[model samples]
Target: MKEKIKKACAIWNPIAGNVRRNEKNIDLAIDFFKQKGYEIVKKATVGPLTATQIARDAAYNGAEYIIAIGGDGTINEVLNGMHDTNAILGIVPMGTANLLARQINIPTNTVKALKSLDNVDIQEVSLGKANDRYFILMTGIGFDGYIISKITSNLKTKYGKLAFAYHATIESFLYSYPVFSMKINGRELTSAFAIVALSKEYGGLFSLTPKANLQSEQFQVCIFHKRGPFTFWKYFISALFRMHDKLPDVTLEYADTIEVYSEEKVWSQIDGELFTQLPVKISIVPKGLKLLVPRTAKHSFPTYKESR
Candidate 1:
């Protein structure tokens, strides 16, 4: 009459954000899972892409649940290493901008996020792939990507989310806006900046793509036609007011695949992590990832015929 114990692996990033605080929270998470009869295994990442390697090993070893204790970048890495496994993904949100956690209604507070694991509400979600890489949230080219590329590790460690804002301000004045040709599901379009988003939220708080839903096998592509200081300010203000979609120069469309090319080299970002240069292909992977969410969370995407 006793329940079976589940194997749970925690991939902790000790230097993600607020190192001391994150370490304490990770300790609490381990204790909580152990109390719930989970056979807990811990792995601490020391450098870039370490979480991905650790996650792959855990999945191959038959871990029932793999929890990432960092930001969106860490979660993205773990997802990439997960392969087509049965392990469910969980988030602890220990970074400056936990956009993935926010989009899925996961608690930003580390303790609360850990406690939500008790619900065991597992769901299969779609993911966006840029080239060979998989992104759980969104990807960007031009302005947003340039800003992320400029934000160094030292700045992030010292100023946290403020680092993004700082670089964005400086880049807005100096960055030369480059034009890119985008083919969205075969429809050709040109834009100065583009964001292919799978979630409604951006930077943890702002809702740049209000119609985006992670559970659906579709992406909300936002294209900005103009690129200048004034234009950027206008877009920023519109985003703050949640009316960017109404702007004349801004276009929002839904697509299952997108291909982008640039005459000149431009940066690209995936899930807040700096990725490769321009000339990339992006597509949606249907029901690609199994994620753990709160039982009470409301999904924006329409329900499928079968629930996982």
Candidate 2:
């Protein structure tokens, strides 16, 4: 009788972040996996959500591990396809803002992360869903979403993280401070913008939702009640000092589900990619997916406990 061969498939974006540097590291990663007795298959994404199609097909063919090799956006696509599969998810953070990698203490350096994966811990974590789509990180609505949509691929490729700062600085003046309605826990609230966070980190090195963590079953919602540019400036300053939670106009709460809509068409960004337009219903799917996390990241996923 022939023994079954171990298999792993990597779905990556060829143009994500620093392409040349990422590809160089990716080559090294493939060779390492090969030496570890896994038959590795590489799939490069050509267009938006191409990773999803690749991931699904690979998993269907019995790949034991579905590895995503790029930024959080790339991971988001692969995850959507393989989240429900029996295969475990592995990440190689090569994108500009590896927020999820940073949040979980996964090595941002590809080679280091690859070496660590051999003795990793398996964790089943919750994921947030916006209507039909699933997101691993936080989702931004209103102003931030508008900014994310306006950022072109060419801009991100050239300026990296600076491109976001450039776009936000210019777009903030043009933004109209659109208000949206949200229903959470049977109470109606209005806000200029909101962020439903499943992870503690929103952007790299910034903790937007303090109570959020990968181990938690629910999201830590941050809603900005005030509108206008001045209010945004205040929030910005407060956030830099990590004092925004104390602001009178800001509210923080934990919830399993939230209903959001706007009077006009407002955009949304899920896991750093431009997602569906407004009227999105966001909720958490508890222990929805499997992940291979290095034990060095053990501090990130503390035992889940209900705070309420």
Which parts of model 2 have CA positions greater than 4 angstroms off?
1-4, 304-308
State which candidate has the highest TM-score. Answer: 1
Error of 2 at 95 (Å): 0.7
Candidate 1 lDDT, 127-177, residue by residue in tens: 899999999889988888888877888788778888888888888888888
- Per-residue CA lDDT of model 2 for 1-308, tens digit only, reads 76566799987788888654557888887887787777999889999989998998999899988989898899999999988888888888888798888876777777677877766777888899999999988888988889888889888877888999888787777789888999998999999889999888876646779889876788999999998877888888898788999999999989989999988878999999899788999999988888878777777777632222
Per-model TM-score versus the true fold: 0.95, 0.95
Pick out the ten consecutive residues of candidate 2 with the lowest summed lDDT.
Answer: 299-308
Give the Cα lDDT of each candidate.
0.84, 0.85
Candidate 2, clashing residue pairs?
A: none
Q: How close is candidate 1 to the true structure, as a TM-score?
A: 0.95
Task: Give candidate 1 regions above 4 Å deviation.
Answer: 299-301, 304-308
